[model samples]
Target: MNQQQSLFDVEETIRNSKSQKASEILTPSTRKILQLLTSQRINKVVTASLLDLAGASHEIVQYIVGPIVTQQNGWQQSIPSWVGKAIAVDRLDTALKEIDKGEVGKLASSSEVVALMMPIAFEVPLSSEWTDVYLWASYDALLRHRPFENFKYDKLWEKIGTTPIQYEKIRSDYETLAADIRSRIVKHAAKEGWGKRSSNKNKHPVKATTTESNIQMEQLSLFS
Candidate 1:
């Protein structure tokens, strides 16, 4: 097929995937954040203000974006071992610090930081089965980052050899894993009474904000 034909065929295939109910829940800022996340290089820092523009919470953004970016950029898997342990250690240390600093409000604007520290939270231990699944899904998504690829159902099932009857099982397993980790982390933070103090620090001053906004506006206008 010609290049144009190939592109069109790919687009058509993507459109045929099982559709979720359309929800108007995502704000414009959230949509923008998703877009930014979808385009980022793995391990790259996406700044707080950019997240503010995207309207995504830190937890949600980290949950969704971290795996994809890391996978695409090539990183370690989530299996329990020294590597996982090391990751867990790092997470713990960071969480403790963030909580002590009362930087909870910054969570919404700091997905990369959260992603790095989540596995260490008391509730979300790195060795837990749930953490494995969460890391696995994120890694898988990253590994298969092509716009037209369907990792959720297709490739994932193929890996586990339970594509048909086990599709639900696979999804359930992963969801359980992710949820467990998230719960643990939150609980740990709460138990430690972290995030009581707030930092009034501003990374971007008013002058920089205005300049960046103007640049973003120009880019938007071009697209429009």
Candidate 2:
């Protein structure tokens, strides 16, 4: 199926998933934020900040609703900062390159810019609880308002003058690099024992107290 259709199917599946109630879709504010991000006329920085705001607001929801939801169904929630960092870095790089080539003015709209940013930004949280929630939320948003096809591949190449093969390779490498970074973070967390610390401590005997107690016991024995 086409990208839009696939996204729609994913959304339907998430809506019907056993882990989430059918009514628990994206919040209206979240939808509005995403809509702004997908709008062609919005500034890129504004879009990014909206995304950041959405993330921050979600933290509150996760804190309040997270425990009950997880207890009922063993769900978890995480923000996956590494993924965000990677995407943000990638977008900055792309923007810089486009600016350097004097091609920034050629873009049709911000929606096109976000489309170009998808492969980098399409990341889920590291923990399973957070991952599931993020995936469901993202899938819901994409289904309601698909933005993948807005990327003008032709215009992008025209601006950057890169061949399709080169672009594909770059995209593939970017994905691989991000995956590697995530894997390393996971491994490090595991090796560190999930941030838990050992609770054992050794105590030394008080030599002066021990000697005084022995002398008192000897005096008591002589009196007996």
Q: What is the C-alpha RMSD of each candidate to the true structure, in Å?
A: 16.4, 26.3
Q: Give each model a TM-score.
A: 0.31, 0.22
State the weakest 10-residue window (summed lDDT) of model 2.
Answer: 214-223
lDDT of 1: 0.31
Clashing pairs in 2: 76-129, 76-130, 77-129, 77-130, 78-130
lDDT for each of the candidates?
A: 0.31, 0.28
Worst 10 residues of 1 by lDDT: 214-223
Q: How close is candidate 1 to the true structure, as a TM-score?
A: 0.31
Candidate 2: tens digits of C-alpha lDDT, residues 1-224: 43234334433443344353212333443343334332322222232222222222222111111111111111112322222222333333333344234342221112222222232234422453333323333332333344457655335434334332332333443344333333333343344333121210111111111111110000101001
Q: Once model 2 is optimally superposed onto the true structure by TM-score, how far is the C-alpha of residue 95 displaced, in angstroms?
A: 22
Model 1 agreement with the true structure over 1-224: per-residue lDDT tens digits: 33234323323332343142112223333333323332321121222222222232344223221221111111113322322222222332333344335353222111222233233333334554444444454444334332335545446545644322322434665544335444444444334332222220143211211211111100001001
